[model samples]
Target chain A: SQTIHQWPATLVQPVGSPLSLECTVEGTSNPNLYWYRQAAGRGLQLLFYSVGIGQISSEVPQNLSASRPQDRQFILSSKKLLLSDSGFYLCAWRAAASYEQYFGPGTRLTVT
Target chain B: AQSVAQPEDQVNVAEGNPLTVKCTYSVSGNPYLFWYVQYPNRGLQFLLKYITGDNLVKGSYGFEAEFNKSQTSFHLKKPSALVSDSALYFCAVRDIRGAGAGKSTFGDGTTLTVKP
Candidate 1:
């Protein structure tokens, strides 16, 4: 069984503050990772995805970035957070052979 | 561009009644469709998928979906609705032969409310 763990379940910060959300998959290696943001009562928006380490693909232009430093580790970072960046952030992993994606618990961010 | 459309913003059904959440997709190549459920403030859970073969696929939580090639629709259906079945449902579509995979286009999720 595979499990994805996301840290800092809830965070509140002021404008221009740094942001870091970490995600790690315990039971899988070399899995495709993705980052998505969902506004309150809205649909999901794809932010970034990585196929391998040091490789990140940005789906939409925003104040966010993603990095896969290790086989099972994925990190979402931002130099400075914006008010619009506040939302529910999710980290997901997809196996090489399967199209189904498994998502983590998600981090609730609030920018004050 | 591959895309998915969930026409209804919400669907209301009474417990013990049949329920149907509609989903339609558009893609250039072969379509890979999926249905997901999301509880309040939680991550999306995969319910069912239609990759190939049988048009009817069964999945978790007593949910099933039927794929119609001519209609270009993959609708989620259940014979009986439960009060616990209330949640947000999303429809997703992917083109198997497209430029890049690991990316699926999703529709604006439909809120399914099962009343007791």
Candidate 2:
């Protein structure tokens, strides 16, 4: 069975602080990875998605960026955090040939 | 482009009663629709999906959704509601042959509350 793992399950950082959230999938290779932020526990806003290593697509202009350094490893990063960046960050992975996405536990980041 | 609409922001249902969460979608090509459930402060869980099969799709936890092509709706239904069913529900659609091929557009979620 495939499983997704994310960390720093929870984080509290001051404004302008650096941010880095990691997501890794085990038991799958060459899967598509995605990063989404859910604010107010409502709708999810797609931030970035990667089809393969070194390939990243940004859904919207934002303070965050994503990278696929390895086939099953994806990282979401920001040079400086903003107050608006506070939310639950979810990382998901879908099979390269399929449409269903599996999600990780998510990181609750709070910017103070 | 593909888009989803969960018209209701909230739904209240009594336990043991039938429950329905409405969802509608738009896409330029054949759509692949999905339903997800989210508990408080947790990641979304894939409940079920409608690919290219029978309209009525059964999923985890006694939940099912009917795909109506003419109506462009995929409404989630449960014959009997449970208090544990209270959570946020999301509808998503992916246009297989459209511009945004790999990405699925999700609707603003609906909150379902099952009362005892």
Candidate 3:
């Protein structure tokens, strides 16, 4: 069975601070990773997706960026956080041949 | 461009009654559709998916969705509603032949409330 793990389940940061959220999937290799943000009562917005190591496709232009440093490790980072960045950040992964995505527990970010 | 639409923002249903959450999509070529459920403050859970073949797809928690090609709709249905079934449901679509083949476009989501 495959399991996805995310760190700092909840985070609170001051405005203009750096942000880093990590996601790692065990039991799967060469999976498609994605980063999404959801505001209160709003639909999810895809921020970035990576097909392979060092390959990242961004869907929205914003203050966040994603990286696939390792086959099973994906990281979402930002040099500086904005107030608008406060939301629930979710990381998901899908098998290379599968269409359904599995999501991690997600991190609740609050930029004050 | 592929897109999904969940017409209702919220759906109220009484327990023991049948429930249906409407979803419609637009995409070129064949569309891969999916349904997900989200509890409060939690990540989305994959309930079911329609990649090919059968129009009726059954998924976790006794939920099923019917794919209507002509109407371009994939509606989630349950034989009987339960209070625990209340949650946010999302419909998503992906175009296999488009530029963003693996990328899915999600609907705004519909909140389902099952009353006792």
Candidate 4:
């Protein structure tokens, strides 16, 4: 069975501080990875997706960026955090031949 | 561009009564539709999907959705509503492979409340 892991399940960052959220999939290779944000009581908004190492496609322009450094490792980063960046960040992965996606536990980011 | 719409902001249903959450989509060529559920402060859980084959797709937790090609709707249905069933439901659509990179467009989501 495949399992997705995200670190710092909850994060509190000061305004203008750097941000980093890490995700790793245990049992899949060459899977497509995605980054999503959800505002309070709102639906998910796609931020970025990566098809392979060093390949990333951004959906909406924002303060955040994503990278696929390794086949099973994806990282979401920002040089400086903004107040508007406070939300729940999710990392999901889907197999190449499958349309279904599996989401991670998620990280609750509160930028103060 | 591919998109999805969940018309209802919220749906309230009494326990033991059937419930339906409506979802519609617009996409070129064949579309791959999916339903996901999110509990409070939790990540989205996969409910069901309509990639191909049958129009009626059964998923986790006794939930099912019917795909109506003419109407362009995939409405989720349940035989009976349970208090635990109260959550946020999201509908997503993506164009078939070779069209795009398999990125899904999501709806605004509908909150379902099952009253006891």
CA RMSD of each candidate after superposition: 0.8, 0.8, 0.7, 1.1
Q: Give the TM-score comparing model 2 with the true structure, all chains together.
A: 0.98
lDDT of 4 at B108: 92
True contacts kept of each: 0.66, 0.72, 0.72, 0.78
Per-residue accuracy of model 1 over A40-65 as CA lDDT, tens digit each = 86688989998889989999998998
- Residues B1-116, candidate 2: write the lDDT tens digits: 78899999999999999999999999988999999999998899999999997999999999999999999999999999999999999999999985789998889999999999
**Which tens-of-lDDT digit does each residue in B1-116 have in candidate 4?**
78889999999999999999999999988899999999987788999999889999999999999999999999999999999999999999998855554899889999999999
User: lDDT tens string, model 3, B1-54?
Assistant: 889999999999999999999999999889999999999988999999999998
Lowest summed lDDT window (length 10), candidate 4 chain A: A39-48
Query: In angstroms, how far off is B24's CA in candidate 4?
Result: 0.5
Clashing pairs in 1: none
What's the DockQ of model 2?
0.84
> What does DockQ come to for candidate 3?
0.83
Model 2, which residues run further than 4 Å from truth?
Answer: none
Q: Candidate 3 regions off by >4 Å?
A: none
Q: In DockQ, how does model 1 score against the reference complex?
A: 0.81
Assess candidate 4 and give its lDDT: 0.92
How accurate locally is residue A40 in candidate 4, as Cα lDDT from 0 to 100?
84
Error of 2 at A62 (Å): 0.9
Question: Can you write out model 1's per-residue Cα lDDT over B1-116, one digit (the tens) per residue?
Answer: 88889999999999999999999998888889999999988889999999999999999989999999999999999999999999999999888986645589889999999999
Worst 10 residues of 2 chain B by lDDT: B97-106
Clash tally, candidates in order: 0, 0, 0, 0
DockQ winner between candidates 3 and 4:
4
Q: TM-score of each model's B chain?
A: 0.97, 0.98, 0.98, 0.96
